[model samples]
Structures are given as structure tokens and as C-alpha cells.
Target chain A: MKVNELVQKLELEVLCEGESFFSDIDGCFAGDLLSLAMSNVRAGNVWITVQTNMNILGIASLTEASCTIVANGMNIPDAVIEKAKDENICLLRSEKGMYELCLSVGELI
Target chain B: MNSFKVQYTIDGEDFSVAGEASRKLKKVLQSLGVDPQIIRKATVAMYEGEINMVIHADGGVIDAEITPEKIHLFLRDKGPGIPDIALAMTEGFSTASDNVRELGFGAGMGLPNMEKYTDYMNIITEIGVGTTIEMIVNTSLS
Candidate 1:
């Protein structure tokens, strides 16, 4: 499924617009640990985490993940949002917890 | 074949900027048309090294050499050296502080992951002096 479709289906907020919202989602990875996430998350997967720091963008780009969904309605910093735009990484915000987000993503993809 | 080299200095004081070097390297590799799989391996290995440098070492320097056949990375730090390389190599071993863990790292998988992704890895360290790690990912690998 494309990211925009998933965003609309889940009612996710676009924290920052990336290069494209039409990127394909291959899978979902839920974690807060950056190192573990980088080591384990598959490319083209939707990364689900509460990490709102700028480093997440680096991890997302490095892993080639489709997009990152910040769970539980956390506030992502403006600098991070700017970096996301610069890196062309789609950043999404979701009010659902990580578990619910994963379940919904699983159903969609 | 021609080669390209880049060097970066990691700041230990800031946890926010830990993976910058690896991210830059990934972009360079992508622009150079390196295989995606190979780029992933190199980026993961080097990013782990960068994290270790920030969490363990006060900071460090990374020197990367990219060539047609392989990507070589050298990570050096002047932090308290690893007292036991073997134990440190263990998957669950970590000396990072609680604060570091709060930042979403220090699971003790950094070195192992680096070794796992790279075709070759070497570590050189001294008790109170520093540590230097060299890792190579062969682009020829399929």
C-alpha cells in the first residue's frame, strides 16, 4: 500500500512532507531503540516508534524505510521536521499506541 | 578502479548527532551507484560504530574509503578502552550509562551487528588509551 493511503486510512497526521507520499510500504517495524531498529528493520517498512528526535530521520534514510510514524501523539521538534524535509523522509504522527498502529499497518499491507 | 575517501569527527557530548557520519556515507555510496545491499551493509556497520563511539568513547573520528571492490571504514576513539574484548563482543554486554539507554541505544549489539554486516572487522584498543575499529564490506559479495 502507498503511504498516503495508509495515512488516510489510519487518520495519521503528516508531521512533515517528504519527497513523496506515494512510496510503497513493504512492512512495519515497531521499536524505540535506534540501534536495534537499524539492525532489524527491513527496507521499505514503516517504522513505528515514539522517538521524535532528529536521529530517527537518519535511521529512516539509512534503512530506506518508507516512513516513520510517531505513536501516542508525541510532539516532534521543529528541527527534526526540517531535517525530515531535507532528507526527504516522510514523518507521520499517530494518536494510537505502537501496538494498535502495528495492527492497522499489518492489515493494510 | 578509482577510490573516494571521507573523514568525519564525531562529538561525544551530543547524542542527537550520533549517526551523521554513517548517514553521509550512505548518501555518498548511493550517489556513487553502489549496490543497495552493499550500501545497507556498510551503512549499518558504520552507524553502529558511530553509536559506539558516541556512547562509549567521548567521541571519535571515522575515515571511510570507497572503491569499486569494497568499502572500508576506520573508527577511532580515545575513550576508556574495552577491558575485555571477548566479553564486550557478547551480544548483551554494555557499559553505557542509564542516560544513554534512555536515548534508545546501548543494548550491547553494536559491535556484533557491525561484525555481522561487514565482510571483515578488526579491533585495536588499549586499556586507558583508546580503541580503533576497521571494517570492510566487499561490494563484490552477492
Candidate 2:
């Protein structure tokens, strides 16, 4: 599934678009532990997490996760959003919790 | 590939700039057209190491030695040297403050993750002095 379709279907809030509009979503991974997530999230996975720090962008870019969906509507810092833009990693936000977000992603991708 | 060393001075304990070292190195590798998987491995190792520097050592220096065959990374920190290297290597063990955990790291996976991603790894430290980690990722390995 492409990211734009999922964004519309899931009603996600796009905090930063980067260049991930049509990027393919290969799978879905949900984790908050940065190291664990680093070791686990595969390339092109739509990673869902509650981590909104700038470091999350690092993890996302390192793992090549297609997009990061910050769950529970967390307030991502401006630095993070700006870094995401600079690095071209898509950052999205959702009002749902991690579990619910995973459920929604499961249905689509 | 020409052999060269790229060094970055990690600044302060600021979480805001935690991963710049690794990120910049990743870009350099990309510019060199390094393999994507190799780049990911190198970046992950250095990113975790960079975060450790900020969280525990109050920042440090990361040097990437790029060559025809591999990339050698040197991470040096002058913080409280690790008391027990074995314990620090164990997964899920951490000495980071609560605030560090709140930033979404500090699950004690830093050193282990570095080992997992690189082809060769070594550590040198003195309790009153500092800690230095050397990791190698060979481009020809995979």
C-alpha cells in the first residue's frame, strides 16, 4: 500500500510530509523502545510508535522505515519535524493509541 | 574508494542534536554510493553510540574512517567511564537517568546493538577517564 492512500483511509494527521507520499508500505511495526525498534523495524515498514523525540527520526531513517506514525497525538518537537523535513522522513500523527493504530494499519497494509 | 577520516564533535548532553553525527555520516556514505544495507548497519551502530555519548558522557567525538573495503568507526567519550563493561553489554541494563528514558532510549540496548550491526567491535576504558569504542563494517562482507 502506498502512504497517501493509507493517510486518507486512516485519517492521519500529517505533521511533516518529507518525500514519503507514494512510498510503499511493506509492513507494519509497532514499538517504542528505540534500540529494540532499531533492531526490528524493517525497510519500508510503516512504523507506529509513541516516541516523538528527535531521536525517533534517527531511528526511522536508520531502519529505512517508510513513515513514522506517532500514536496518541503526541506533540512532536519542532526540531524533530524540521529534521524530518531535512532528512525527508515522513512524520505522521494520529489520535489513537498504539494498539488501535496497529489495528488500523493491519486492516489496510 | 579513497581512504579518509570524517570526524564529528558531539556537543553537550542536548537530546535535540543527539544523532547528528550518525546522520551526517550516513549522508557521506550515501554520496559515496555505499550499499544500502551496509549504510544501515553502519548508521545504526553509530547512531546508538552517538545517543550514548549524549546521555551518559555529555557528548563526545565520532570518527568514521572510510576506505575501499570498510568503514572503521571510533567513538570516544570522556564521561564517567563504565564501571562494569559486562553489565553494560548486557541487554536491558542501563545507568541512564529517568529523563533519558522519557526521551525514548535507555532500554540498555546501545552497546549490544552496536555489536549486532558491525563486523568487528572493541572497547577501551578507564573509570576516571573515558570510554572508547571501535567498530568496523566491511563493505565486502555482505
Candidate 3:
């Protein structure tokens, strides 16, 4: 499924405007640890995490993940949003917790 | 085999730019038409090394050599070196402070994950001097 579809289905807030919203997502990986996420997440997967820092953007780009959904309505940093825009990474925010977000993403993909 | 080399200086104090080297290397590998799987492995391994340099080494130098057969990464850091290679290699063993942990890292999975993704890895370290890590990811599986 595409990132825009997931956003519509999950009712996630688009944090940054990017081309990846049309990118296809394979699955979902939920984790806060950067290394673990990088090591485990499959390319084209949607990363569900509570991490709001800029490193998440770096990881997203490195892993080539389709998008990042910050769970639990956390306030993503402005710098992170800007970087997301610059990198063309789809950044989204969700009111649901990690588990719910993962479930929704899993069902979609 | 044709070879290309690139070097990056990691700033230990800057968490924001920790994975820049790995990201750039990924692009280079992509442009060179390396296999995506091999590129992913190299990028992940190097990224973990880059993060380790920032979190533990207070900065370091990364030298990457890309060839037809493999991608080689040499990371050298001037920080408090690991006292026990075995212990440090163990998963879930971390010495990072609380502040570092707050950034969602320091789970002690960095080195282990790097080893997992790469075909070969080696670490040379001294107590107070520093640590140097060499990792290689083969482009083609044997």
C-alpha cells in the first residue's frame, strides 16, 4: 500500500510534505532504538516509533523506508520536519500508540 | 577491479549528523550500481559505526573503499577505547550515559548489528588511546 493510503486509513497527520507519500510500503517495524531499527527494518516499510528526534530522519533515509509515523501524538521537532521535507521523506504523526499504528499499518500492507 | 574511496569526519558532539557518512555512502553505492542488498548491509554497518563514534569516541574518521567485490569501511576514533572487546561485542552491553540513551540509542546493539550485516568485521582498540574498526561487506555472496 502507498503511504498516502496508510495516512488515510490510520488517520495520521502529515507532518511534512514529500514525494514518498506515494511510495509503496511493504510492512511496518516499531522501535525507538536507532541501531535496532536500522538493523531490523525492511526497506519500503513504515517505521512506527515514538522518537521525535532528527536521527530518525537519517535512519529513514538510510534504510530507504517509505515513511515514518511518530506515535502517540508526540510533537516532532521543527528541524526534523524541515529535514524530512528536504530529504523527501514522508513524516506522519498519529494519536494511536505504537502497537495500534503497527496493527493498522500491517493490515494495510 | 575498479575501486573508489571516500572519507568522512564524524563529529562526536553532533548527534544530528551522525549518519551522514552512511547516507552519502549509500548514494555512492547506488550510483555505482552495487546490489541493493549489499548496499544496505554496508550502509547499516557503517551507520552503526558512525553512531558509535559520536556516542562513544567523541568523533572519528571514516574511510570507505568500494570495489567490484566488496565495500570496505575503516573507522578510527580518538576516544576512550573499549577495555574488553568480548564484553563490548556482547549484545545489550552499553556504557553510554543517560543523555545518550534519551536520544533512543545506547542499547548496545550497534557493534553487534554491524557485525551481523557485514561479511567481515574487526576491532582494534587501546584502553586510553582509541579504537579502530574495519568492516567489509561482500557485493556478491559466495
Candidate 4:
């Protein structure tokens, strides 16, 4: 699923679009723990987390994650949004909490 | 097959800039046309080490050497060393503060993840002195 689709499906706001569009996601891992997420998530997984920080972009880069969904309507810091754009990592914002967002996205995937 | 080297200083006192070195290394490897799997391994291993540096030590230095044969990484920190390497290697054990946990790391899997992805890992530390970790990821065969 492309990030645009996710944005539309979940009614998420586009905080920033990194590198245009990524068409498909292989899996989904919803976690904030960097170590566990890196070890368990695959290259194309859509990372769903509430943490809106630059390190999230770093983790996305390491894991080659397709997109990052910041859950619970959290405000993303400007520096982080810029970094995500620079690194071509898509960033999305969801008003829903972590659990519900994961469940809905999981159903889509 | 030529060798490339880059060095980065990690400030352990600041958690915000933890993975800068790993992020740069990943980009360099990608540009070098390294296999995705090998690049992923190197990046993840180095990232774990990078996070450990910030969380445990005040910070440290990460030296990355990339060549056709392998990727060599060194993370050296001047912080309280790990007293029990065996226990620290466990999956769920973590000495990270609650504040660090809230930032989405310090789950106690740093060393284990680094070890899992690299072909060789060496950790040397003295309780009061510091800790140094050296990891090698073979790229030629993989």
C-alpha cells in the first residue's frame, strides 16, 4: 500500500512526504522500542509508532521501512519533519491511538 | 574493493543525536552498491552500538570502515562499563532509565541485536574505565 493510500484510508494528515510515493508494504510492526522493531521488522514494513523524533527517521533508514505513521495526533517537531524529508522517509500523522491504528492498518495490509 | 573510512563522535549526554553516524553509514553503503541485506546488517549493528553509546556512556566514537570484503565498526565509550556481559546480553534486561524508555529505546537488546547481525563482535570493558565494542560484517560472501 502506498503512503497516500494509507493517508486516505486512515484519514491521516500528511506531515511530510519523503521521496514521493512508496507503492507497497510487506508487513507492519507497531512498536516504539527501537531495538525490538529493528530486529523484528522487515525492509518494507510500515512502521507505526507514537514517537515523533529524528531517531525515528534513523530507525526507518536502518530498517528500510516503507513509511512511518506517527499515531495519536501528536505534533511532529519541525526538525524531525525536515530530517524525514531529507532522508526520503515518508511521515504521516494519525489521530487514532497506537492500538487502533495498528489494527486498522493491519487489516489493510 | 577500495576501503573507505569515516569517524563520528557520539555525545552520550544527548540522546537526540544518537543515530547520526549509523544513518550516514547506511547512505554511504547504499551509494557504494552494497547488497541490501549487507547494508541492513551493518546499519542495524552500528545503530544498536550507537544507541548503547548514548544511553549507557555519555557518548562515544564510531569508526566505520567499508571495503569489498567486509564492514568494520568500532564503538568506544568512556562511561561506566557493563559489569555483567552475560546478564546484559539477555533480551529483556535493561539498565536504561524510564525516561530513555519513553523515547522508544533501551529495551536491553542493543548488544544482542548487534551480535545477531554481525559476523564477529568483541566487547571489552572495565567497570570504572569504559567499554569498547568491535563488530565485523562480512560482505563478500553474504
Q: Chain B TM per candidate, please? A: 0.97, 0.97, 0.97, 0.95
Residue A101 in candidate 1, Cα distance off native in Å: 1.0
TM-score of chain B alone in model 4: 0.95
Per-residue alpha-carbon lDDT of candidate 2 for residues A30-96, written as tens digits (9 for 90 to 100): 9998888988899999999998887888788778888999999988888878888888888999999
- TM-score of the A-chain for all models: 0.96, 0.96, 0.94, 0.91
**Lowest-scoring 10 consecutive residues by lDDT in candidate 2 chain B?**
B12-21
Give one digit per residue, the lDDT tens place, for model 1 in B40-128: 99999999999899888889899999999999999999999999999999998999898877767888889999999999999999989
The DockQ figures for the candidates are 0.79, 0.76, 0.89, 0.79
Order of models, best DockQ first: 3, 4, 1, 2
RMSD of each: 1.3, 1.5, 1.1, 1.8
Candidate 1 lDDT score at position B126: 100
- Report how far residue A88 has shifted in candidate 2, in Å: 3.2
Q: lDDT by residue for model 3 over A5-106, one digit each (tens)? A: 888888889987477889788878899998889988888888889999989998899887888889999988798898888888888899999988777677
Please give the distance, in angstroms, between residue A17's alpha carbon in candidate 4 and its true position after superposition: 1.0
Better of 2 and 4 by DockQ: 4
What overall lDDT goes with each candidate model? 0.90, 0.89, 0.89, 0.85
Model 2 - which docking category? medium
lDDT of 2 by residue, B1-142 (tens): 7897899999865787788788799899999989888988999899889989988888988889999899999999998898899999999999989998987789999999999999999999999799999999999754
Residue by residue across B21-53, what tens digits does model 3's lDDT show? Answer: 889999999999998889989999999999999
lDDT of 3 at B110: 89
Docking band of candidate 4: medium
